[model samples]
Target: MPTSTRTVAEELLYRIGEGDTERIAELFADDVDWKLDWPEAEHGRPATPWIRHRSTPADAAANFRELAEHHVAEGAATEVERILIDGGDAVVLGEIRRTARPTGRAYRARFALHLTVEDGRVTRFHIYEDSLAVAQAFER
Candidate 1:
């Protein structure tokens, strides 16, 4: 028997949905490479705040802070639609029901994330999501 990568990924996704940033950090390796790609220039102001390129857990904490401060809102919710894991690699498909703060606008989007897990820790993370919709939500 072995530690199922899929199970690990599922727990990770669950923690994310729970808004448990500390638990999320505990799941990452010391030197984790996390990236959220949303070109600010093209996506506009709203998407600008959430985009990040972090190389460590500390960096991820900062990114999460920014997300919580600006992007994550009271009504925001995440649903994991699917998860596929092969060895140390995993892909998660999900949807976000988010409402941008201050403006209180709907910024719903679907997303897919690729994650690499080794020794029960996540080493790499890359996410793809609908940035245009987020930008549009911020439009005033």
Candidate 2:
């Protein structure tokens, strides 16, 4: 029997908590519809480095890697409030806390992650968060 979308979403969350980039990439389809809901240009500055266009599973892994590179690992945490699943889609509501390595400033922001799974792999991934808070954290 094929894996359910809920199972795929749960596994993805588990792997993310484990910080397993390879495992996370394995959960994605080759060509994924990835989107980060943040302004590309804010005050004439470009978006964060990790906010690039991504399609392949390798790009997904690289995205996580870039995020880690930009933030302090210590005291970083994700508090998942809830997960709602229906058919092939899952919506994860959570808050993320991280300190920016560049400025050593910490920011906490609520997030909504939408994942669409099909054929046992995630085909679409979209995340909405407080971009201003995150950007301020990296400001000098």
Counting clashing residue pairs in each candidate, in order, gives 0, 0
lDDT of 1 by residue, 29-76 (tens): 899877666764553254455575678776666666667776646678
Error of 1 at 18 (Å): 2.0
Each prediction's whole-model lDDT (CA): 0.75, 0.87
Q: Write the per-residue lDDT of candidate 2 for residues 1-140, one digit (tens) a residue.
A: 23798889889988887888998899999999998887666522433688867999999999888788888899999999999999999999999999988888999999999999999999999999998899888776
Clashing pairs in 1: none
Misplaced by over 4 Å in model 1 are 1-3, 40-47
Pull out the clashing pairs in model 2.
none
What's the CA error at residue 35 for candidate 2, in Å? 0.5
Error of 1 at 111 (Å): 0.5
TM-score against native, each model = 0.84, 0.92
Score residue 6 of candidate 2 by CA lDDT: 84
